[model samples]
Structures are given as structure tokens and as C-alpha cells.
Target chain A: MSLMDKMLALDQRIIFALMFIALAFPILSPVILPMNIQQYSRDSFEFADSIPSGSVVLIEGGLGAATYPQGGPGLEVQIVHLLSKDIKLVFFSIGTETAAWTVTAIDNALAKLPSGVAAENGVNWVHMGYVPGGESGVAAFANDIRSVKTEDHFGTPIGQIPLMSDINKASDFAALFWWGGSEGSIPFGIRQIVTPFGVPMTGMCTTNEVPNYTPYINSGQMIGIIGGVRGSAEYEYLMGMPGLALGQAMATNFGGLLWALLVVLGNVLYFVARREGGAK
Target chain B: MQIPMILTAVIGLLMIIEFFFPMPASVTSLNVTLRSFVTIISATALILGTIVLTIFHTKKVGTRGSEWYYSIVYVVAFVVTAGLGVLNVRDTTFLWIYNNMTSPIGAALYSLTAFYITSAAYRVLRARNWNAAVLLVCALVVLLMLIPIGAILFPPVVPLGEWIRSFPSGAGFRGMIIGTSLGIMGLGVRVFMGRQKEHLGIREERRDSE
Candidate 1:
């Protein structure tokens, strides 16, 4: 076979090996990536920064274990930042079994924070648990938070939770942060909670959904956004708390470069083989 | 049929009714009960999905397929992560799997898309016709706008990119949203009225006499 033909017909195993090596090498190295911090990440951090101490903030952890790598890190950083500012947080999950995952992420993030920076659980923050019905649930919460969330995830009544006592509706919270998956409770929250109540809101979404959500950001419907893990890293960096997010972004960037190299090599081999065979 | 769908229809009707008039305590209690049932059903579905995935991979490995090793890796990872998860062993093994295996694999998988995109762009941007040329130009413009080099080429392209996103692309997205909304509404009405029999896996037969 011609060189180009042989190159074009390269074994799938070789390609896979190359990819593995490329990704593995970079991941093992501690190389900082030059990432463009979109306005959304900055705006999201600024929005969190602007909130006064002890202000009420509602965080809807609208993702599950499957999407942890993307939205999970962002949620972690946001929680830490909020905790550092002494913000009273009301946590709830809107997507697939997120209550458990949200709790885990919160605990992990709090543990990673500098000694004594983490908020004391149940005192500074309370988890209201997973609310079903998507948009309908958000509408219900908007109308009357107490009516929808009768008790905390652990069966503690809302009236008893110190942070929840001040929050009766969307208007009560100083701000809202929603991390949304493709099909989650955030759309409903945007329509019902933020729009009608005029409560400032921010979102952390997967990178694929960033383009679609930018309009909401520009329209003032959403105050800011943290798009994917990169956004999470930026937020972590801005907070002066380098954690999993920074590591993940660096790994992702290295992986991207390696992937680019493989593609270039593969194409060059294919073209060279083809030229030698006089088929091009 | 599934219990969840039945509960959904019944509760949905009641919810709509509650909107029009005051619902009694019994009706409100029933609605909450139904909501809890749906949540339980969804959790069960998640478990079922995981089981199905495990079985599929296990079968592949048992059959000694070309990628049997990969299937073995998949099962091992799945079992280790899930087993630790179920046992509530969150600190050591579970967290290690999450931080090392899951995180890196997830990042690698997603980052690979960038390579595929470049290859796809190369093949798709070939000059074939006016439409193709227009498509190529627009794609390049958008691609350039996405990268930092585009801003260096022309600083105004940033705002222009923002304008294109908010105006033209946004209009297209809105059109899609409206179309999808209409389609969903139509389907929902049909299903609600019990006219969409396909969901039941039953085909209607025309009467010869008619």
C-alpha cells in the first residue's frame, strides 16, 4: 500500500493510544492554561461579591452526578464564596436525584475552604430538598415559598429554619443562583422567580448551553453566568480559592492541545498517503 | 401503563382545577402525595437505567469482544464508584474515583469534540455552490468570533459577535422555540384527550364496512 493509503488505514488502536497518551501526559503535568474569562464568569463573581453579608441567597443545584464535572465544580465555588461572605443560603435541587449530590458537593467544597472559612451547617445555610414539577414548582415557590416547601429535606419545617424564616417568596431573597442542565428547573425559575419578582439572578450552565443563555444575560433577565468547568475555575481563581475547578480546566486545556495535534498528524498522514497513491 | 403517567394526569387535572377554584385540603394532600410518588418513580427509573447499563457492558465483556478490556474497565469503574456510593463511603475510594477517573475521563471526552469540530469544518467548508459559500463564510465568521484571535484581528468584532448572537441567531432560536412550543402543545393536547394511541402500542384498524 502507498504511504498515504497506509496512513489513512491506520489502526483504530494506534489512534486511541495516541489520544490516551496525549491526554494523560498533560493531565499529569501541572500546566496552567491561558483561558479567556468570559464576561459571564466575571459578572457572576461580581454579583456574588456585591451581595451584603448575611443576605439571603437561594441556590438551586439543578444537576446530578452525571453532570458533576461541569456544573458541580461551579456550584462548589459559588457555595464557598457565598459562605465566606456570611450569606444565608437556601439550597434546593431541581434535577435528577440532585439532593444527595448537592449535599455531597456542598460538604466537599466547605471542607476544601480555608480553615474556619466554611459556614456552619444548618445555622448559616439550610437545604430545602428536591422540589419536583419543574416550572410548576418554581411558580408555586414564587407565589408562596412556605406553601411549596413545607419542610427542609430532613423534614424540618420551614418556619423553624432560621434562614428560611425571612424568605416567604422570590422578593425576600437578595439574589438567586441557579445551575441548570439542559432540562432542569432553571427555565421555570427564570420565568416565574426572576422575571416577575425582579430578583437579580445568575446561572451556571454547561458550555453547550452558553450561546442560548447569553441573550438572557444581555436582556438583564440573568445578572451573570458561569459557563462550564472553565467558568468554575475562573470563579475559584477570582475568589482566591484554587480547587478542583482549576485543575479540571488545566487538564481540559492540555487535552484540547493534544487533540489538536493528533488531528493535524492524522490529516497529514492521510493526505501524504493519498498523494503517493496518485489518487489525489 | 406506568403508575407515574396515571398519577401525572390525575394530579395535573387537579392542579388545573385548583387554578380555577379553591382546592379542598383532601385534594391538596392528594396532590402532594402524587408528587412524592412521581419522585419515587423517577428514582427507580434512574436505578433501572444503571442496571441496564451494567448488564449491557457485562455481556459485552463476557462475549470477548474486541473492546472487552474497555468494557471490563467500564464495569470495574461503575461497580467501584456505585458500590462505594451505596455504602455511603464518600471519603476515600468514592472521592478518589470521582476526582481521578470520572473527572479526567469526562474532561477528555468533552475536549475531544474540538478535534472532531475542526475535521468536520474542513470537510464541510468546501466550495460547492453559492449556498455553500455563504455557509462557509458564516461558519468562519462565527468560529473566528469564538476565538481570541478574532478580537485581535478586529476589536469591534467582539461587539459585532455579540450583536449577531443577540439579533440574528437569537431570532432564529426564537423561531425554533415557537415551533417547538406549538408542536409540544399539539402533542400534549392529543395525549391528554387520549387520541394519541401510538403511545399504547395499539394500531387502529379501519372498518371494511365503512
Candidate 2:
């Protein structure tokens, strides 16, 4: 075979091995790379920062096990940020799996809270875990909190929860933050809560889904969006609490670099083989 | 079937009307109750699905069908996990299963996508034509723009990628969303008017009667 033909026929196992190394190397020993925060992330951070103290805000924790690593750091940081500001948070997840992971994020955040933040459960925050039906469940929860959930995640009755006493519906909250992950339920929040009650909202979605939700931001239905692990790293950076996400983002950079080079190489080989009439 | 049709229409109309019109407290309360039913029904459906899955796998294992060993794995996993979950999902054993086993398995499966995509990009991202070349360039720019090292390697890729995403990709997604919204509205109207019976699991047979 010609050199071009052999190059064009390079085995994909080699590519996979390289990619595995590319993804794993930084995770083993971390490196920091220069990353300018994207506009969408900045908008999301600013929206969270803009919330007034003591104002109640609703959060939809929609990150499942597969998505937790990407959006979890950002969720933890956002919890810390809001709790430190003394903003009351009401969290609910639409999926059973996501609800549990949300609890983990909350616990991690709670551990990192500033001294004397008054983040008492059922008072400063309440997790109405695992609201079942997707959009319909969001609509129901938005319409009447007690209609869907009578108790918090820890099995505390909602009626006895001091934070939930005055909050019966969506309008009671000042803002909405949807850490939607890969659920694609940010639109559910926009439709059921923001559109109906005129509550401003921000969202977080997986990296690829970012483009799909950007129009909502432009149309003003959503204030902003945090897109994937890079977005999470940006959130950590903005909060001045650099964590796992920043290092993970660097790993992503390494993977992307290797992937891009392979693509270019494959294309070059294809063109050369085609010119020599030795390509498929 | 007719009763379900009527109920679907009534509840769907109530929600639509409630959205557009200011309803009295009594009407709002009724609508709230109806919407909450969706959650209960969805949960019931989940349980039903689980039962159906268990039955399918049990029969496979009983009959020694293709990949019956896999069925054995599923049966064991399901029984153990579900038993623990039923006893108390918050129990430490159940939580350990979920956190260690289920969570890691899911994450590993998801990470496999990166490997496949890397190989696929190398093989399938070739530009053999004019339109393909444009797409390839755009994909390259956007990929570079998204990763942290892109700006360090090439500065202009940032703005180029932003323009591509904010305009062409954004407009494409916007168009898709609008189309999907309209399609959903059409489907809702069909369902509400009893023209769509498939959602109710009542298929309309068009075969000739012999």
C-alpha cells in the first residue's frame, strides 16, 4: 500500500488509546489552562449575584448520575453563593435519581458554607425531592406546592417547614435557577413558572444542549445559562472557590485538542489518498 | 376509552384555559388537583414498566433464550436493588448501592461516548465536497472555541465560533423549537378533539374486515 493509503487506514484503536490517555492524564496530575469565561456563564453568574438577600428563589435540580460530574460543582457553588447571601432556596428534582444527587450537592455546599450562615433545613432551604411527572409535575409544583409534595426530602412535613409557610405557588419566589443538566427541562421551568408567574430564571444544561437553550436567553424567558463542566469551572472561578470542575475542564481541553488533531490528520490523509486514487 | 377521551379533553382544556384566563380559586384548586394526578399516574406507569421488564427478563431466563445469562444478571441486580429500595431507599445499604455501583456504572457508560466520538470524528469528519468543507470548518472552529486551550492556540477562533453558534446554530435551533412547538400544538388539538387515540393506547385499525 502507498504511504497515503496506509495513513488513511490507520486503526481506530490507536485513536481510542490516545483519547483515553488524553482524557486521563490531566485527571491524574492536574494542569491549569487559560480559559476566558463565556458570555452565557457570566450572565448566569450575574443573574445569581443580582438576587436580593432574603428573597426566596426556586431551583430545579435535574442532574442525574451521568450528568452530576459536569453540573454538580456548579450546583454546589450556587448553593453556597445563595446561602451565603442569606437567600432562601427551595429545590426540587423531577427525576428520582437526580433528587438524590442533588442532596449530595447540597451536602457538599453546606459543608463549605461561611460561619453562621443560618442555613437551617426547612427554614433557609427545603428540598422537595423527586417530583415525578416531567413537565406536568413542574406545572403542578409551580401551581401549588402542597398539591404535589406534602413533605421535604428528609420526610419533614411541608406545613411544619417555616420556609414553606408563605410559599404556596411559583409567584412567591423572586427568581428561578434550573440546573437542568441533560434533562432538557429548562424549558419546563420557562413555560410553567417563568412564563406564567413572570419570575426571572437562569438555567444550566450539558455543553451540547447550550445552543438549543440560548434562544430562550435572547428572548428573555431565561436570564442566562451555564453550559457543562467548563461552565461549572467558570462558576467556581467567579465564586472564587476553585474546585474539581476547573481541573476537569482542563482534561476536557486535552481531549478536545487530541480529537481535533486526529480529525485534521484523517482529513489530510483522505485527501492525499484520493489524489493518488487509493482511497475509498 | 370514551371516558378517558372525555377526561383528557376536559383536563387539557382546563389547563389551557387556566393559562390564558384568570380562574376563580375553586377552579384553580380543581385544576391543581388534576395536574397533580399526572405525577401519581406517571409514578404508577414507572412501577408498571418495572413489572413488565422483570417479567420479560424472567421469561427469557426460564426459556434459556438468547443471552439468558444477561437476564440472570438483570434479575439478580433488580431483585437486590429493588428489595433494598423497597425496604428503605434512604437506608445506608441502598444508598451505597446507588452511590457506588449505579452512579459509577452510569458515569462510565456516559464517558464511553467520548471515546466513540473521538474515533468517529477521525473517520467521518472528512470533507469530500464543497458543503462538507464548510461544515467541517465550522465544526472545527466551534470545537476549538468551546475547549479552554482554543483561545491560547488561536485567538480569532473565539469570535468565529461565537458568531457561528449565536447566529447559524442558534437560528437553526430556534427554527426547530418553533416547529416542534407548532407540532405539539397540533398534536394537542388532535388529542383533545379525539382524533388521536394512540396516546390512550387504542390504535385505530385500518385493515379490511374479512
Misplaced by over 4 Å in model 1 are: A1-37, A62-74, A95-118, A128-172, A181-185, A195-199, A233-280, B1-10, B17-30, B50-115, B125-157, B197-210
The residue pairs that clash in candidate 2, if any, are none
Error of 1 at B192 (Å): 1.8
**lDDT per residue (tens digit) for residues A93-151 in model 1:** 76535675688778877876667764766678888887765666666666566656678
lDDT of 2 by residue, A157-273 (tens): 988999999999999999999999999888899889988899999989999899888788778789778999989999999999999899888888788889889889999888877
DockQ of each: 0.15, 0.79
Q: Tell me how far the alpha carbon of residue B158 in candidate 2 is from the true structure, in angstroms, after superposition.
A: 1.3
Return the TM-scores of chain A for each candidate in numbered order: 0.86, 0.97
Chain A, model 2: TM: 0.97
Quote the lDDT for A134 in model 2.
93
TM-score (chain B only), all candidates: 0.79, 0.91
How much is A30 displaced in model 1, in angstroms?
A: 7.1
Task: Please give, as one word, the docking class of candidate 2.
Answer: medium
Cand. 1 Cα-lDDT = 0.69
